[model samples]
Target chain A: MGAKRIGKQTWKPEHPPVIISAAAVVGPFEGQGPFKDYFDHIYTDIMAGERSFEAAEKEMLLNACFTCLNKANRTPQDMDFFLAGDILNQTISSSFSALELRIPFFGIYGACSTSAEGLALAAMLVDGGFASFVLAGTSSHNASAERQYRYPTEYGFSRKPHVQWTVTGAGAALVARDGEGPRITFLTVGKVQDFGIKDPLNLGAAMAPAAVDTMVRHFADTGNGPEYYDLIVTGDLGKFGHSLAVKMAVSNGGFDLSKNYQDCGLMLYDTRKQDVHAGGSGCAASATVTYGYLYRKLMDGELKRVLLVATGALHSPVTCFQGNNIPGIAHAVSLEMI
Target chain B: MARDPKRKPLTVDQKRYTEMVRDLVPRPPYLRNSLLAFLFGGLVAIIGQFFTDIYRITMNMSVKEAGNPAVATMIFIGALLTGLGVFDKIARYAGAGLVVPVTGFANSVVSSALEFKREGLVFGIGSKMFILAGSVITFGVVTAFFVGLIYALFVF
Candidate 1:
């Protein structure tokens, strides 16, 4: 199918305007600097002591939320709504982070795609005249995640090379009333795909098909080919999944991925150095690219049009044992600075 | 209460036999532990490709000749290591150690299922089922943008 533009969802600064003033946040777990140096230690502290998930999330989010608000020269109360989520069971990180803001809150669950999803939803609400301004953010913690999801600290199991490093930090973006920056032009909610590969340890290979599906759809929906955007980014498919995604795009979907880059786990981390197995986590993949790469490039005026395709793997052990396949989903949010 | 022996007092040997329970646990030979990892690590690295190949073919399929010597060689190596149980041993030693690259991944799914049998369907099987694969999605997005971002900065 040719790329088809959905409803008129374009937002220019001059039009019934909600401007995106500043996009900033505290982390992304990138540097071996202060945040990384103390990540494991703080994570250990939270995991070892008697603390609720809420408290831990609260501690992490405050640092990031404050950083974002400080950067925007705005306070939490200035935002009409605070949108956020994490890999936690109930999005405790965002919920607790919201406690201090006292702004109307909306908690989201898009896994790693939460960044784009949050931004897209916030944009839509602004464009639709539901609200004037909104702030969106997402964060993830490695220590809290490892214990909650997999084996505990006691059982020392060596990680595989293709594993993703769960990000230890957080990031936030501010969407304001007729501000300056790249505007959200087009967004296509992805169609979920499943390959029936039921191994949690090896994720990249499993998510390739979904990434392919979404990329294909985004192009088809927009009627814009690969040439439209300067870059096409897919959220964490890891190294293995990234390769598979490329192979599928070229060989199966008939699109060349040689030019496209992925934000998978393996691509983000040096497994040998960090024992992350793959690269980084869902939040890390998006957070790093959004802050570390995308925003930076946008600031530099390197390119005007870009497409962010954030992919996610929706699976739980119970579903796998129930003999279910891994369901993959991707959301494409197009960014263009005018 | 005095022990009431059926018929007669139990003899020491009989009592010992009755009280003695055979330990079914496999004892580790210190010698086998060290050398096993190196051997198994190589085997795992080679066989790990089987999972990769299958996944590649299934998702990113290439319609090359199905039955070629190269393919045979790959399968032969996979079977040889799998039969030696070297891959399984590596899995036992290295959590992602074996699973990280490829062959170990299959073992991870199977082993994790074996470990948390009680979480039964959801927690044990379902949760562990596609748990870490999010990394793939995470990286897929990152690299796509990273490449694009880099292209914007340098190449573009």
Candidate 2:
């Protein structure tokens, strides 16, 4: 077993890393959304009895990571590496949680694509015999995200029809080389794709092309089309971006993603009822859905193999305000039941 | 001057793909949005005008002085509406139309404060009470002061 480089941007690991345990913690809003039962803990309030939404986000991730470890009957000392990320300013939420956990930490930032990136990186590390037990996770809080990206939720500004509400949740999973669970087999790192979209509101449009790019590349590299996977899940393209990505895949990627394609953003919330304008985005959007609902379905024998392509809009509020076009990235991780 | 991170331009095919993507995705209903904005905005304005008229008729002040009180009164009404959780409902439909008025300013200030009421008073309310409108109010005051200073100089 050596370096698992298959083609350009694709990693076919010699030994797939097993997802031993997964945990998700969400706020009241997320708890009320579609997949409430899948989440381990959903606080009745965003604060989670903390002072600020930032503090709440940190708490949520810490709790989720703790749950992940506890489920695997492992302690903090058992973890070889803790990989985490968030959409916070400087990724403060994950940073603070890492500091508390005291594991060999790798702080990641892939915008909303963070969860899949963490899983991909953790799996690679585990497969390469670098680390045995890796905890990979990410967190996001709607209030904290709003305070940072848009106006604070309290501002009562008119909600933009195209803007996505950042999910108020955290998700964590334990990945190991030797375990009896679902395994990660392939990872296709995305290229930076900028379609020259400048509007912060049009995030779905901004990230759709990147998702389409990585997805098509994954199919080409693996020599398997969309029909191979039980589900093709994108991280957080939301409603419009998900639709646009499907359109691109059909025409450009030479495959129809209509049958198996389901976006994490769309799955977590009933769009018609929830006022989550565009849909849910942020690290937690994909994180929770993957670690909770998707993993549970895999365990329940509903899905055998799934291709999770997490998309990210890599634009800071500064870049958006500065009138620069948004750059997008997507990472593909193929998962299978062992 | 060069851009710090100068990204390469998309290829001709990628550009075409992007156009196709933009077209495939639905544009938000601009016509409905404008209609809602107009209807909700007009209603808010009518309510504000009613308050202004009341102040004009009742108060023993000039039209200009009455305007100050009227605006203040409207802000008070806005804060009250926000506290009752009614202002947000109006804003959802009214968009920027309602936000351009005195009520919108009040909504911005009060909403932040109220949202953070759980975070305790000093840092939450005292410090963050004006997260949204603080800059706008500051700019308005500063600009007015400078303009007023110049106008006073000219008049005197």
Candidate 3:
């Protein structure tokens, strides 16, 4: 049997793929966050014993992948495909880590929404009998991202209150054909939505529309209401984007997601204590939260059903400098523990 | 500032959505930020004045001659604070207050130098040291030249 096509962009696989094992490895700052206990390994040094911040980011991704493979009692040779990405030039972290893993790799990029994108594709591969086990992973580092996108680490630039702090972490999940874990039941692919927001710093406002659009589409496609899932989590909308999503979902889609809705950006850090202006962002924001915290919740039977919508801002430094508005994208994956 | 001809105009729904987002997003506290900038900027000027006085009194230099030493002292202090990782912390709250002085220029150069030091000394630190401050220098010199040209041609 083949994968079933649902409403619009959603897909329902004939045999749902199982997320067997997931792991999260974070840097020192993320280790101090509220969900620190859920993470597998926490590096005290941001460098992760590496010389460059880029090298450190690669190390975190490799660590997460290995930890995930080990947890499932699987080796790198056992995996069929390695799907990974990061917020770096050419997705270097993923490609470099794939070099070490030696798994046939597919390097992807959806900005911060890479985790869900990988998961959806992994599920398709598994359900289609293309692979028995596929490793889906993604990572992002604060220093590396800052140096690439905004400024240097030591630059004395004042961040606005709406500016989000990029998360320094990596997360990986092993998706298999048969396993005793949460199943990937449904996936809703989002279209790129541009709201004509030009401020590169105000990412939350830019990405909110795409996140809401995906959420509304997911519900409409699956014929599920806001209350159908135990929890509905968005990738890195932060404070402003999360509220905007809540409002837009109601106004546009006629879906009230005021309850049982949380953003991984907000959940990853303590906004009051941590100096993260809005909240944590980057690819790792959703990857770590969903793979570590939400995965555990599913395993422990705490949450029977969950809708994970990871949002991404599709803008480059060149585009931003050229005054092009940032386009946003989001992909949703429904996890159900039968 | 004409709109880009290639870009399509915003639709009615898109315009309404933009308005809603504008309302939802929080605006920075401009009044409070301005007051902080003013207070801190005043403090920086006072410190500069003190350095100028010290140079004038201790070395018996003229006010005009002491100005160079005073500016140098302020820049040195700024570089030191930036190296110690204290300038950004203070700048977070001080806003334009800490950024309007010569100290801000020092911070910009030193910070870029420190950040790019990993790439190597010549290509990294030497070339990139002026990455941020180059703009200020270029524009400053150009504006000064234009002003002087105007004075030479007309007033002078």
Q: What share of the true interface contacts does candidate 3 keep?
A: 0.55
Question: Chain A TM-score of model 2 versus the true structure?
Answer: 0.98
**Which is the leading candidate under DockQ?**
3
TM-score of chain A, predicted model 1, versus the true chain A, to 2 decimals: 0.84
Writing each residue's lDDT as its tens digit, candidate 1 over B1-156 gives 232235345456334322221121123444554465566566655554564576557666553442243345544543344445454544556444344444443434444444344466888667765444445556878999889988899985
lDDT of 2 by residue, A1-338 (tens): 23677767899878899999999999898898889999999899888998878999999999999999999999999999999999998999999999999999999999999998999999988988899999998999998887777775646556656788789999999999888778998999999898878778778888998999999999988898999999999989988898888888887878999998999988999889988887999899999999989999998989999998988889988887666788999999998996
Model 1 chain B scores worst on lDDT over the 10 consecutive residues at: B17-26
Q: Write the per-residue lDDT of candidate 2 for residues B28-100, one digit (tens) a residue.
A: 7778778877887787778777767788888766667677777888889889989988887778877767787
lDDT per residue for candidate 3 within A1-338, as digits (tens), equals 23498888899989999999999999999898899999999999999999999999999999999999999999999999999999899999999999999999999999999999999999999998899999999999999999889877777756678899999999999999998999999999999999988888889888999999998988888899889999999999999899999998988899988989999999999888999988889999999999989999999999999999999999998888766888999999999998
Candidate 1 wrongly placed segments (more than 4 Å): A1-29, A33-54, A264-267, A270-273, B1-156
The candidate with the higher lDDT, 1 or 3, is 3
Best by TM-score: 3
Off by over 4 Å in 2: B1-11, B56-64, B83-86, B111-156
Sorting all predicted structures by lDDT, with the top scorer first, yields: 3, 2, 1
